[model samples]
Target: MNLEHFDAIYQRAAERKGGELALESMLSTPLTQQELLSITDDRWLSAFSMKVFQSGMSWKVVRNKWPNFEELFFGFKIGPLLMLSDEQWEAKSIDKRIIRHHSKVMSIAANAQMIYEAGIKHGSFAQMVAQWPSDDITGLWLYLKKHGQRLGGNTGPYALRQMGVDTFILSQDVEAYLRSYKIIEGGRDTKRSLAQCNQAFSFWQQQSGRSLTHISQIIAFSCGDNRM
Candidate 1:
């Protein structure tokens, strides 16, 4: 990766109002799977509560009910969550209560239990969330089979996409870094690593024995800035 090019991209994003607003908006926004792992507090409850809440409800309704959730869930404490049983789940699952669905409400309780059990193996709830299995595999080969074992849990790729999007400043640097290179339309895919792409680029440059910059300019000229 060209660090200079990457830095320039970041500089540009830093100059954009969309980038600035994205940063501010995502600050208190609910965290993603990756964010959940990175965080060690009841923020998980807070974030997941909102997520589970919205599973069947509209964002607007959930938004309105958010304060109620915070008050009802006690900021997502694991101990308090564990204390909540199937009956308690049903009781608080009242339509007026913050959570509603029986299955989903039961899931919240079950997921908390699951998280707690996972913590036993990983030493902490954060580690359990951090260690959740992913569906994509990573490897030197480009084929899906080679890298399909998936790393970083089933949500790794999803997290990567979120990490690259500048809709939230949560991933501005990532978006900027990738945009700095000729990564093409798609962002730096999890299946394809920078190291692997760099290796390919170096091999291709040597075989072609020509600077890619010149080749690109020539192609751009032939295609025209408007059409290619």
Candidate 2:
């Protein structure tokens, strides 16, 4: 399908945000591949767990209690986390220091196992993420969804973005923009729809010479009522 040039979208976003300078200031840059590589496995698990807990909950509350999560989970060290006994996990589910959600509490260990296996296969989970091609970020997202718990939909993508992986979040505004342009059709979570989005973002990246993160923000800013 044909798509509008990235310049036109940027112009609209710039107008909405006040000016080109203001729009540029609002866009965020993803970390470099080397920077992503330098991060350890534990940190990746921490990011994943945070996103999982933050889902359908107050981010501020999760952030406030994050230190306790780190302490209780042994800083999310993969080795120790993978070894927790059933009774130990049960105790953590009711711990007052955390949000007390049993299912989400269980996801921590499940995701840790996913990361541990990825580490064994790819030298480290960070290496696998660092080496993933930015052009095919959906593939990485699919991998997480298949291997980890509660990592489907935006959860996996959000976690990857938080951990410095170059990815575009399919937020409400972004989805609306894609549908308006006819760049995607039907269910947003379907593989076909995601592939369409990947193609559209790839085209925009080529036209703008920008990262997926920036392009995503531009699309969001260009639409909806986010005017500044």
In candidate 2, stretches whose alpha carbon ends up further than 4 angstroms from where it belongs are none
TM-score of 1: 0.44
Candidate 1, number of clashes: 10
Report clash pairs, candidate 1. Answer: 132-153, 133-153, 133-154, 134-153, 134-154, 136-150, 137-147, 137-148, 137-149, 137-150
60-161: candidate 2 lDDT, tens digit per residue? 999999999999999999999888899999999999998899999999999999989999999999889999988889999999999999999899999988
Q: Clash totals for all models, in order?
A: 10, 0
Residues 1-228 of candidate 1: C-alpha lDDT, one tens digit per residue:
433332232234334425645523323233355664676536544554455555446868877878877777666677898887667767777847564666655655654555466568677766554453322112211221122222122122232222221111112333333354543225454434534344433443455443322222222222213121
TM-score list, all predictions: 0.44, 0.97
Best by TM-score: 2
Q: lDDT of model 1 at residue 76?
A: 66
Clashing pairs in 2: none
